[model samples]
Target chain A: MSNTLEISNLSKNYGDFQLKDVSFTLPTGYIMGLIGPNGAGKTTVIKTIMNLVMKDKGEVQLFGKDHRDFEIEAKKRIGFVYDTPNYYEHLSLKRLKNVIAPFYDRWDENIFMDLVGRFEIPLNKPLKKFSKGMAMKSSIALALSHHAEFIVMDEPTSGLDPVVRREMLDFLRNLMEDEKKSILFSSHITTDIEQVADYITFMHKGKVVFSKTKDAVREQYALVKGGNELINEATKQHFVAVRTGAYGFEGLTDDVSQTKKILSNSAIYEKATLEDIMFFNNIKTKAEG
Target chain B: MVQLILKDFRVHALLVVICLAALFAASTLYIALVLLSGNGFKTELMLYTLITILSSSAVSLLFFIQDEMFKTDAVFVSLPVSRKQLVWSKYISSIVLLLLAFTAHFFGFQLGVVINNGVGFEGAVVYEGPLLWCMLLLAVVAFKSYAFPLYFKFGMATGGMVFSVFQLLVVIAFLYSLQFETWTDQINAVVVWAEQRSLGGLFGMLLCLVVLLTSGSMPLSAQLFKNKNLGT
Candidate 1:
């Protein structure tokens, strides 16, 4: 599949933190989940894509065009939903929509109205009074209404309740049925990523740990559970992260088949969930530090 | 761009009405005083007109403060338009609003003369007022030119403070310049020049200066906004 976005060697520095050589691609018709902890530079990456923040070194090509060279045109095709969505909060949704509609060449009032209807948003209420979910819904409505080919959201599900998050994930899934839309969303909620993402880009402390297909991820990492005594120092090295609970021991292994041989039927190997994969990666990074 | 300007007008509709009313009240006072005393209201008109224009120009500062308060610049930057377009829209809308204020104040002065004096001011005097009005607009434009570059560099609050300081400095400089003999000569020379010139020439010169200062400021604001690391 052709890529909708391609970021190569992306980097940004902000005194105390630096995003080092991050890169990723979201293929057409796929949802790429950017999973990272708080302050992992996910928002920075999203901002860089939107050119809201300056990148020290990188190439971000959207729809095969350099983002800076064709900044306006590239942005025309981008649907950006910021984490907080702080617009002109004093303006009502209808008024804000009018304010924003003129800038986009393909802005469809009908599509915008439809999205508002789908979200059941009150058109006349200013966004300042909106609940967090409502604010996110409004931002999504704005992004989706412009016939944007690529939708990039920064931590959109971070503070949402599970029900709203599920609804959001389902809505994104429905969007992907169109086969031309692509989504790149950041979330710490692994379940949300598992529910909708075809690909995962895991980041930690301003660096991309891995970018892989979800299926490949499932096949790559295995959760091995066995007795505490079964865990040796030599065997622990094979696991990305290890936990020795009173009941038993559970650890994650990227080399699942080799680990299965090393453990030799003493431990049970199960398919690793995205949550497990993310958790283990985070633990592994912390352990190394 | 129209949408944005319209938004500004909508947001400040009440303020605009209040300002226009104040202008009328101030103009009526000046006109009534001059007509009853049988002397020109030039000094009084200059003071009141300066106050009206300054207040109107100050209202434009709310646009920046509002944008900053809500962090709406973040949303704007995320929009599918170039930063240059955004900068141009703001500059044009602000100047348009200043013009609107100038126009409203002119009408208010005219209306005030008719209402308070029941007889119009002298043909030459009333026609000559636009020259001073042009200068008022130039002052407001100069204020904006000084304020906006700082606004793009810093956020609204600091820029507002800086602009206030700029005004204070202008006042202080004027006070200091009064102590100089050359400054008194220049003031007399300007008064003589004003008496010598036609209203058209005075207005044309002030308008040209206003346009020059305002136009010059646009590129500075645009460049600052372009280089700005607008945070999300």
Candidate 2:
């Protein structure tokens, strides 16, 4: 299957912060979660792809076309939702819809109206009066109304309550039932990503750590708990990160079999959640720096 | 481009109405004072020109402030429209607004003239003529051309502060020039020369200047906007 979005060697410098040769791909009909700790440049990647932030050097292919050369055409097929909805808040939802609807060639008024009704967004109230959840729903409705083939959302689940976040994730899953739509969802919330992403791209400190299928990541990474006697400076090299307690030690390793070889089957191995992977990686990175 | 232009109008429809109403009120009051003062028609025209220009600037600035509040720049850039289209939309919308403000002033001034006629004020200048139009267009185009680049480069609040300082400097220079007879004579000389060549020639020259400034301003604004980090 063709890739929905392909970014290679993306770089952007903001003096104190930078995105360093970031690269990733999302195949059509899959949800790729871009997960990292805060300030990891996930939002920057999304912004660069949408051309909201100009890349210093890179190639971005969206819908199999160079993003820069066919920017208008590429964007026509993209549904971009910002972390914070940046709509004119003084206008009512209906008025805002009227203003934005004409710009998209495939905008479906019926779909928009239906989403508004289903999401229970008020058509007559100004967006400033909307709750955060309502505002997000409105943004999603607008993004989807254009019959967009690929949607790039930046931190959509942040600041949301668990129930609302779950519903939003469920809605995204339902959207994927079409088998042609793809999503590149950026979020710091690992649980949210774990819940909905078919693939995961982990990033840290302006660099992409790994981009692979979620099942592969799950199978490859593991958490090990064992007595302190089983740990040493040599064995520590096997774990990406290790935390020691008074009586025991817990560690994260990307290669379960290699870690087992180092530990000699003494440690209890458990599946590493996305949170565990992110936390351990962060700890290791901070320790190294 | 039309959608982007219409977006601004629809979003700021209330503000536009309020500005036009205020402009009408100001125009009506100024026209009455000019008629009551009984024959400073030249001064009246100048004052009216200043009022319309200031009103247009104020309206556009208010619209920009609204845009900043909503982070509309970020939203627009994310749309299918190019940065060039976004900049052109602003220029077009500003021109449309300038024309709207001019129309509002025209109707208001005409209303004042009708009222003055009823009050038996025969000596009042009935029509300010094409000079007013030329001055109004020149002031707005020049100001917007200079200001838009600053705004696109440095954002609305900072650019506005700088633009205000520039306006203050221009006012100071104008006042300082008034104290010098030679400067006044040179200006008068130019005006006399232009009128000698016919007012149409002068109007055409001002319009050409407007076109040139606007043409140069647009690409600069577009280029600035293209690299602008919106949320940054």
Best by TM-score: 2
DockQ score of each predicted structure, in the order shown? 0.54, 0.73
Restricting to chain A, the TM-score for each candidate equals 0.96, 0.98
Best by lDDT: 2
TM-scores for every predicted model? 0.88, 0.92
| Residue runs of model 2 more than 4 Å from their true location after superposition | B37-48, B118-127, B177-203
Give the C-alpha interface root-mean-square deviation per candidate. Answer: 2.1, 1.2
Per-candidate chain B TM: 0.72, 0.80
Evaluate model 2: give its lDDT.
0.83
Per-residue lDDT of A238 in model 1:
90
For candidate 1, chain B by itself scores a TM value of 0.72
Candidate 2 lDDT, tens digit per residue, A1-289?
9999999999999999999999888999999999999999998898888888889998999989888788899888889887656567777889888888999999999999999988999999988898888888888998999999999998998888788798899999999998999999999999999999999999999999999999999999999999999889989989899999998999999989988888877899999999999999999999989
Least well predicted 10-residue stretch by lDDT in candidate 2 chain B: B119-128
